[model samples]
Target: MKKISIIILLFSCFVYGQNKQLLYNFTDIPQSLLSNPGAEVNYKWHVGIPLLSHIHANAGASGTSVYDLFADNGIDFNEKLRRVVYSMNKNDFFTVNQQLEIFSGGFAIGPSYEKNKYLSFGLYQEMDLHLYFPKDYAVLAYEGNRDNIGRVFDLSDLNAKGELISVLHVGLTTKLNKKWTYGFRGKIYSSLLNFKSTNNKGSFVTQEGTNNFYYHTFDLDLAFQTSGFASLVDLENEGQNDWNGKAIKELRKRVLFGGNLGLGLDVGFTYHPKEQWTVTGSIQDLGFIHHTKDVETYTLKGEYTFEGVNPLFPNNGSGQTADEYWQEIEDTFDDLFELDTITKNYTSWRSPKLNGSVSYKYGKKVLKECNCTAEDGDYLNEVGLQIYAIGRPRRPQTAVTAFYYRRLFSFLSGKVTYTADTFSKTNIGLGISSHIGNVNFYIMADNLLEYQNLAKANYASVQLGFNYIFPATKK
Candidate 1:
């Protein structure tokens, strides 16, 4: 029972962390193109260094951390688990998101050197999960209803979604003028696995009754769903004996475009109101997938009421056996709450995200000896604020970050950020980009201060990539 409770809590604690706040609008790195396709880049062409091009991972939890569960203090494990569960709220959550790039590259596509149009394309794999804390369900599971006589357990606390998909994308960016640049990206999503359950209703309650000392009532409407994983598990007997080497090989084949398919779009623009002020915005993942293969759905919808059972032998012969009495009760309960499992095709929409930022450049002008088209060029220092939001099952999660950027030398640039969000209020991040001749590299990390003791940290992320760039020839 404790093992089951732990699994439920782990699944219920998920939250999304794909904001990539530090990398937004950092134009030196080509991976920034994924966040905002309209980002301005002065290079003529660029190519990612194969598999090492871009790698990212982010994880966060609202009410608890890894230290609470694994710390080597002299305390009972069950007691610590109870304390953590009780400290969390129904709205608190945990989330994880990760991406790996296979290959990416971009180049100029116009006839004239003066033309400012560019094309970019790439392929990557991603996995993401979001789950709200199931506080009511946890209480009911851990401590049975023997002590609480009138309290009710809510069923709506069950809400979670997760997905694994591979994406193929192409984009085009064109400068309308010296002050404005616009871009659009087309995406094809191949979903490998997906699961979601939300919008549940009903509850369970116990009270004193006229016919008996206690009466219990259960009114539940619950559903669980899955796609691309039904064939790997033995649902009939709730077993995994068939999940062997052959099963894994078949699953691997579906990771490509061999599963469900969908389409999405991302549109963005960068505007320079003046020479010193810049603004940018973008919307991403506006799409849906149709699950027409390997689908499984389970549903339970019914209401049942039970009073104390009557005594079989009232001070007469032998009393009813405990096993027989409990067996009868179980049969009656099963009949009341009819369970159904079926295979049905369905469609699900991707969680759309919105990003916007504004920045002002100041300080001394930087000189570019290689490509000198103007007397004054990029600035040595800048400051900016960024806003991000993503759609969720209950509401949209939002975050705000303020950052300062600096160019220490001709080949080194970096940015520092402070952010406030649902997971934590003290998220600090750093990003650095370096160029040695034609080769460019960048690395970014969020919540850096918490790395000192990872057990107490609520959120952490890191991203790194490499690219080869070519400068435009002097006319």
Candidate 2:
């Protein structure tokens, strides 16, 4: 039943990792500044379309797809379930990441405007959930220990994390000389809720004993921490009449300055070492969050050995009764886990991200001379190799992408990317940015090959946004 439950979870829920191959260096959209603070901007002033500026979400399972289970075949459903379980390993994981831009705008500033200097600001809300497959736990729960005596099941397999937070940020960008341009962004993070249980250590082992068919031993050192959740639960307890209004009020407070807050920084730059070649690099989320309010940490540490347990009642009924026997079993579990809860403050680091790319451009697309604007990237074609990495709880996730860019018209441009990562090497993505007068709109998506049958795709993601821009005017 546990295995079935896991399969169901895989079928209904999943998340795409935070690798936006199509949008990473697509600088036409102002959102590119979020990824690379130093990204070049041609607009003198810009404003996002309120909450519609950017909306992004990606969903899929890493190890299996829904079609794998529901496909009509001659095989029995139980057999299909068994195959799915056996195919997964501890390395398989599920994750969900989403973001919404609330309000954003930027404009040219001061005397630096003549030198291409600009200031930008924005606020956004984000959510992330990551969980790894508990392979050993599933096996032990489904098959029991009698079949695999002496095999140790690792407790470390139970690793997962979830968080919901909002960020308000401001950045400064400027072009220095002809070869280098750089920028930095300062962010304030307001955490609404967070939960993580990772870095576990322990083992569960079963072996033959003198008194029974098998003996079991549990050694555990595990912790689970959370914030902003206790207050929500207390609010729900108030009753259904005012729960909606109160919850909304509470969420608004948390998303703003009322919740646990932290600070972070992002820095990046572009370098033109040659006329035709370019290099760029950036680092994001270099910060940590201190969970001091509405915080709770649960820990389980201790060791226990169990020889066996018998539930058979004596014929005379003179020994232990049913209630006492069950109570004894419950006491045994409590002793082994030694569960304890404490309201303690803790600090958690953000999953810092790294991005770097080398690109070459050619094929000039001559444009009509303009009085106010200098030509930037006159070339119509570009090719590049980009590397990406993001820190995770257990290890750093990485990916490599090869991309090509083309300018189809004065107002239309497109990019195509081929990426190789932990999910799959055949991942292909496309992004298009269009300029109709002063409105800038762009959309990007990954896993294009699976569009025909999205249900069978292991990874998929898309991002779209609209913004208004005022063209630069030379002073």
Candidate 3:
């Protein structure tokens, strides 16, 4: 049942135009939502796996992994498709790149130092892996199921096991930095994404349907984030002397590089004059990632017919004999296979991000003296009201907007809350931390709100972790 469910899910994504629609609204929304407008955040990191879901339709349901694959592949195909002035340019259509498969994972440890009046730093290490599947095999899997009539047919066998690629992030912390602190990370990311797929011309007769689905070997991708831009800028400029008072056009083109480059940065800071509140912000994921692959295309055709008597496979029952059923199906479809267009384009791309947080802290602890002394018993309780913007610059006519708040009960416990686009999406979080003989234990529950989005079936998270703070000492 689970397998069937998953398969159904995959099919729905393929046929339902499952694509991540870009968010283009700015209004009262949650801080979390605003922080990463079009980009997916690592918020689900603590949940064990990356959150591939979308927050678009109240349900937050994201397109399947194949949707992502196809979109990216489509981007490549579209580019190549644009250059072909002739539809019969099969040479431009069929091209293949070598398949490369790579995988790796590891761990690390270290300490870092931050030089800021209110910042401290610590060091750490991590491990990660990268994977790539060649286009030939990928397209072959896509066209593996074909019917008669030269319609290369079946859609069910295109499923490919997604590589379990992982990456470790370990680095310095800008703790104590009252404002403006910086940190660095050393990341090692590697993987094998090599794949091959092929489709042979063939015709099949069946009771499934009349129009045969043709299979084509070609590269498909949604975007060139890592490839397009690189190819564009790498061009070298060369020009010949002008003739007849006309300037010569400069000849230039991008050079393809073998290895990919990864970039990252982490900077955060805070300001708190009084003992109660502070303002903080930072930027993350400021870099680019690359993926390479070989592509292939194929052609196919199939036919489907309907007959009355057969009850085993109902839907307009196919005839008793498989051949008879196929014969009837052939009546619906004629020639299924024919020469078509095949094309490939090369390009690269990139994505950038920014985020910030702020809040007003008010409470007894904040309003009282430094600490409870012999003269002063206890202080008043404290509460915090926070609001911040992330993602693109805040606009008035946007669809979604957000801000987050946290009411702190001293330093041991507190509540985290957020509101997005008014009552559209709201989240409440609670956390507590206590020290048992110098050992500190903490737990937090996020997304307390009941949100209905296309991207999410049901989204909630609970995390348990501990951090130890060494006591300040005198030398």
Candidate 4:
């Protein structure tokens, strides 16, 4: 159990905001297409530089931080653990997400005279995880019910979901007159692995009994389902041996549409209410996958009452062997409470995300003075507010951010943002994009204030990428 907790903590460190609000409208980089297909593109063509194209990792925890557990201040480790567990609520959760662009490129497909139509395509891999705090179960397992005799442990506290998938997508963006631009993307998802164990019900209670000093009752209905994982574990020697590299090889082969497949769609639109004001919205990953291969499920459902086991001596036998007595007790316990493991196919859905923003440019006249075309509404300075939401098992999580963008020079631009979300309210982020003769470089980070004392931070994220772009010919 301690090992499991450590693993969870380590994973949580890799988690927060998938929104990337600061980079949303930054049209200098081609990777912004993934977030909003309708985002304006000023370049004629762009290509991501191999593996260094786009790499993003974000993680967040709502309840505690690494400093809460590992900070050495002469306090007992067990006492610290107890304090951390008790301080957390049942709804607290840890989330982690990562995305890497394997290969990507885009180009204008229409005639040279007509620059309104463009096509973009890419293949990327992503992993997402969400684990809720199991407060009742943790207390019951860690401290036991001996201290609190009447406390009841609720099974609903166990809720978690995780998935790893690769996405191949193609998108088309076109201008629909002078005020509106729309885009659509079609995605093919190849699921590498998945796990889900929500929707549980029941409880465990210990109280005074009529005949025995204490009585225990357990009514549990639980099911844990997983796919593409069991076959990777070698149980020949009771799971003591490592996998023989066959599963990883198979997974690698399936990265290109060979695994469990699914379809998704992204739709977005940009509306220009006025010359200086614009509104943009997008919805992504509206799809599901059917897991039909290498699936495993475990279920436990029963109601049992224990009033202390009573030993019986048989008259026919001179003396009951220790193994026989223990075997009899185990068999009786199995009869009272049963657990079943089965293999069956299942279906899972991708978490749908929504993003919307409104921005107003203020220094457009300055661009004209600097000999900038400003045809695509590129402004020298702008401020905007962005809202983001994603659907989860329990509820939808939401975040909001206010950002300021500045085009410092012809080749350099930057953005600053302040965000409020489930993790923290004082999240300040910065993003910078630079073009050195058509070679584009961009990087962004969140929670800048916590970098000095990272252990006290509940959330942190950074994204960096490089791309090669060809400028549009001067008219």
Which one is best on lDDT?
2
TM-score of 4: 0.90
Give one digit per residue, the lDDT tens place, for model 4 in 433-468: 999999999999988988787777888888999999
What TM-score does model 3 achieve against the real structure? 0.39
Clashes per candidate (backbone, < 3 Å): 4, 1, 119, 4
The best-first sequence of candidates by lDDT reads: 2, 4, 1, 3
Off by over 4 Å in 2: 1-12, 72-74, 236-245, 309-330, 366-377, 473-475
- Worst 10-residue lDDT window for candidate 4 reads 234-243
lDDT of 1 by residue, 152-199 (tens): 989889888888888889999888888999899899888888887876
lDDT agreement with native, every candidate: 0.82, 0.83, 0.29, 0.82
lDDT of 1 at 396: 92
* TM-score to true structure, per model: 0.89, 0.90, 0.39, 0.90
Mark the regions of model 3 whose C-alpha exceeds 4 Å error after superposition: 1-5, 8-165, 168-170, 173-261, 273-277, 292-353, 366-411, 421-424, 449-458, 471-475
Q: Which stretch of 10 consecutive residues in model 3 shows the poorest summed lDDT?
A: 18-27
- Model 2, range 1-475, lDDT digits (tens) per residue? 7686865466334556888777777877888888888887767899999998988888666677765665677788677767766788887877788999999999877575374777899999988887787888878876888788999999999888888889999999888866888999999999998888987889999988878877788899889999988887788545776887887789889888788888899999888899788898999999878899999888998888877555457554557765677678779798767768899998877789999999998887664565333255467889999999988888888889999999888788999999888777788999999989989899999989988877787788899999998867533
**Worst 10-residue lDDT window, candidate 1:** 234-243
